[model samples]
Target: MLMSGSVSLYTDKASLYDVDYLSKDYAVEATFLQQLICNAIQYSPAEKPHLLDVACGTGNHLQFLQEMFVCTGIDLNSSMLAIAKQKIPQAIFQQADMTNFDLAEKFDVIICLFSSLYYLLDTALITRTLQMFVRHLTSNGMIIIEPWLTPDKYEEGKCAVQANQTANVSLTRLSVSRRQRDVALIDMYYTVYDGKNVTSFQDTHAFLLLPHTVLQGIFDSLGYATEVIMKAPFQERGLIVAKAK
Candidate 1:
């Protein structure tokens, strides 16, 4: 199963985490998130959208969202929020948990990107978060979600992948032991060899891997019109878009 710890990755040993290396991953994730947002806006009934980016680490997507909509981000990490505030000065960033967060206003489009929804580690928690998303959505709003690979598609195991540089750092990372059937867990051991020094750090994340049908059923029960698209363009990830019924 995917094991996770509460230890902050951005502690004093931040060099071990390699912000430059992770920034590349964040870029790709932002591209996908933008695409999803664009599609949702095109299909949505709203002219100008209001977006909520749940677990918006460092506000990368939130910055992009601000270009087209009034965007707000919510994340559990204050340091990340501080960085995000620097990046998107006009947008708002709040510290909140996705599974049980409450906001007074609803949004026209709500996005939980980069598999952050999986961090909840429980199917019930995932469901609760979805319900909350629905509750916080305008009547015609859409909820766009991207989840990690299910056990049926990619089994739990170890794999090493190299990242293309988008910043000063280039690195290779190993993903070890992602074996939660109901929830996908991955431990990324990233090794960064800066010109002067070498450092390594691990980021363990857990994601709920509910089947597409299960998610559809949940949305249907909640009076939503849902669509599940596998292998979306611009990336090899799956997407679920749900609109109010």
Candidate 2:
């Protein structure tokens, strides 16, 4: 029951950040992801690779990647997938769990960004997902994963705040009380203000926090040529790039 008691403090809709919120911090995060993709493509031997974005939230990265590559997006959340579909009508989007998910086709590039891989809190599940990724990737294909900070690197009970204003509404969110159980859970509280009214919401979300070394080892065990890049643009975070052997 890790992260069993978590809650999301917003409306039934996905975070406004998914649609309208674009702060400097968010921009920076997007830039970092783009750079990672570019680097992977540059290093990959495959030309015109087919790309898959797992846990593809609102399809932000998919939309960005489609310009240069044939991209497909998958997510478990129907609402998020709906949004993604609207954003990238030309791209293929599907509903699939990150773990225990299978597609008949193989991909040349697979990416799990923004700590989406963290949803599989158990190490065994994470390893299983990695194996699935390997099976679905073509020879010489590469897998890129970005996971949240490990528990040892996180500040217990830490808090962070973000705010964004749009033409129609403004949003303020507070993330507090980081919890480390079998899974990492964060308590998020959000306040949404429309022109005439204000509303509040809360939801708890959980993510797995695996050690960097463990991820590298799993990639190796799966016959991947692995590399680890730590703290690229954010402290306490890292990326793992694994190419099929």
Q: Quick one: best TM-score, which candidate?
A: 2
Q: What local distance difference test score does each model get?
A: 0.71, 0.75
**Residues forming the 10-long window of minimal summed lDDT in candidate 2:** 1-10
As a whole number from 0 to 100, the lDDT of residue 137 in candidate 1 is 93
N/CA/C clash count, model 2: 12
TM per candidate comes to 0.80, 0.85
Candidate 1 lDDT by residue in tens digits, 1-245? 23333334643333334353453455555566667667655543455578899988777667656767788899887777777888899987899888888888889889886667767766677789899998899887889887666557756776767564434655666776676557666777665655556566667666666666777787888898888766534244577789978
At residue 69, give the lDDT of candidate 2.
Answer: 72
Worst 10 residues of 1 by lDDT: 11-20
Q: Tens digit of lDDT per residue, candidate 2, span 1-245? A: 11222333222556575633465354465567666667765543455568899988888777767766788998888778888899889898999888878788898789898788887778888899998899889887788887787778766588989888888888787888667664677877777777877877776778776778888888889888887777646544677889866
Judged by lDDT against the true structure, how good is candidate 2? 0.75
Cα misplacement distance, residue 239 of candidate 2 (Å): 0.8
